[model samples]
Target: MADEIKPAAQQQVQIPVDVSNRETVYANFVQAHLNADEVYLELGQFSQVVTPTGPDPIVLSHRVIMNFVTAKRLADLLRRAVSQHEQMFGVVEVDPNRRLRVQQPPV
Candidate 1:
């Protein structure tokens, strides 16, 4: 069998994320393509996420809308990297009444 042809059962996963101000974050990735060359990824762009806390503010997230695109494999790698990170440490928790917040310019 030639490498050009992939099994029909092989599914190209797609990872999409919806960054919101819920103060909670979750992510998933979909692999669109796989090859030997450079990997590619398609990261969703977020307009803004601002969750204000109480008196003091500390945490902040600044997201830049990346118009660029990446291949399916690269995207998958990125998704894994994020997963490993969370596992090693812990899930990033958003404090509703903490001393920090997430802010970004309107998209």
Candidate 2:
């Protein structure tokens, strides 16, 4: 005789997540880091987030960072930021008037 078999049952589940407003987060962070020199300038980024606006694109993201390891943070930030950039505005380039980075690749 063939072995008896049965199909598996299915179940549904629901999960909750805390959604934070991006703008609010930024504001809070700023308030915390305001007027301080202990906050060393490690790294930062400047981005331009763009959206489709008729024939031309619109600027959307313009971000900057200032927290990370030292000695290589500046270069690392610049390299990373441009890599994640989108072509909504125009050729986005960083003029990092540095002696070392000028020789390394954008990456």
Candidate 3:
């Protein structure tokens, strides 16, 4: 059987986007909360404080709520972007100690 071809308009879509007043935020820390319907992403800045007692506490500053489907799409997109970035530059290490080692020049 011959394969059918879709019309140009049906095959492709062009979406018009306006970002004149869009806000940009930078987050060093992120926490995820998932429910049955949606996912909550708490974005924040993390700072390490040296105390005489125990480990430092993380404080959250901002949050963004998205649906499960959107969260999944974001995850997939981020994964692909990170993979491509690692291929072009280098792997991004999350651990502080490991990151220091990875950044050191080879002998």
CA shift at 84, candidate 2, in angstroms?
Answer: 36
User: Can you write out model 1's per-residue Cα lDDT over 56-84, one digit (the tens) per residue?
Assistant: 33232422222234444555887899889
Candidate 3 global lDDT: 0.84
lDDT of 2 by residue, 17-41 (tens): 7678544312111111312323332
lDDT of 3 at 86: 96
TM-score of each: 0.25, 0.20, 0.73
Question: Using alpha carbons, what is the TM-score of model 3?
Answer: 0.73
Residue-level lDDT tens digits of model 3 in 6-101: 766645668999999898877888989888998999987766676789657777877889998888899999999999999999888888888777
Clashes of each: 12, 4, 0
Give the higher-lDDT candidate: 1 or 3. Answer: 3
Clashing pairs in 3: none
At residue 79, give the lDDT of candidate 1: 82
Which 10 successive residues of model 1 have the least lDDT summed? 58-67
- Sorting all predicted structures by lDDT, with the top scorer first, yields 3, 1, 2
- Stretches of model 3 off by over 4 angstroms after superposition: 1-11, 49-59, 102-107
